[model samples]
Target: MILRDVSFAVAPGESLAIVGSSGSGKSTLLGLLAGLDVPTRGSVSLNGIDIFALDEDGRARLRGELAGFVFQSFQLLPALNALENVMLPLELAGAKDARQRAEHSLAQVGLSARSLHRPQHLSGGEQQRVALARAFVTRPRILFADEPTGNLDHATGAQVIELMLELNRAQGTTLILVTHDVALAGRCGRQLRLEAGSVVQ
Candidate 1:
């Protein structure tokens, strides 16, 4: 098992950092928390609902309603411009003003000028900013970030970190991030250290 006997609780509007070396099950734990993976045992609850008790479609619906995600790779569709990337989630959720909300979100990330540019045309930091805009556009109750700054240079990563924490505080979005950077983990309200698929702290 990639993860075993791991358990924890995150409060509403809290920021949590999960840290560990590679192969310590950080990503796997994230997937389970996000309801993107089903554990062979144990339960994960969100907003007082047990996610694993629901079917895949049910869990998906819950995610659509409450969750936003950022990834190390900046998981934007290459064909979609920054604005479009941000709009995708809002559109999926049947928002009537997806364009306006997306534009505002991109502006929040200081990417209005780059809104028309696709991922290929943007720098790594810009792409990640776009991803951030997309994640926050939904204004989700929970935000999951998996190595969100892993690909950026140190300076760029710091900028992204600042923006992320600022946004989290402003929106009261619960932040759950997996990272190897202790300094980054220290930014969270609490830190959960993992070792060999278990919580060591």
Candidate 2:
């Protein structure tokens, strides 16, 4: 197992950071927490629901209804413009106002003028901001971010972090941030340290 006997809880609207060195399973833990991967043992509960108790499709349905994710790579589709990428989740959830909501989300990230730009056309920070807009557009109850600033320079990364925290507060959503930057980890309300697949602190 990549992680063993690692356990913790996050309160609603609370911010938590998981920090560790390379290959220490921080990303693995985040994936399990988000239900993107099932653990070999134990269980993960989201909003009081034991995700492990559900089948794959059921877990996916629940994830779609409750979670938002931001990754180090930004993960925006190259073919989709900022507006379209932000609208993808809302559209999948059958929201009739996906466009309007996506626009509002983009505006929140100060990316309104770049809404028509594709991923390749935007800068790194702008691309990440678009990814943020997409993640928040769903108004998810929880947000999972893994090394969200890994690909940005110092200043841009700080800006992204500030924006994420601002959105988390505004929406009253729980945040689980995974990163190696100690300063970044300190920005969270609480911190978890992992080492060799186990919780060390």
TM-score of each: 0.98, 0.98
Candidate 1 regions exceeding 4 Å error are: none
The parts of candidate 2 lying over 4 Å away from their true place are: none
User: What C-alpha lDDT do the candidate models reach, one value each?
Assistant: 0.94, 0.94
Candidate 2 lDDT score relative to the true structure: 0.94
Candidate 2 matches the true fold with a TM-score of: 0.98
lDDT of 1 by residue, 1-201 (tens): 878778788999999999999999999999999999999999999999999999999999999999999999999999899999999999999999999999999999999999999999999999999999999999999999999999998899989999999999999999999998766888889999889999996
RMSD of each: 0.8, 0.7
Q: Could you give candidate 2's per-residue lDDT for residues 80-120 as a string of tens digits?
A: 99999999999999999999999999999999999999999
Note the residue pairs that clash in candidate 2.
none
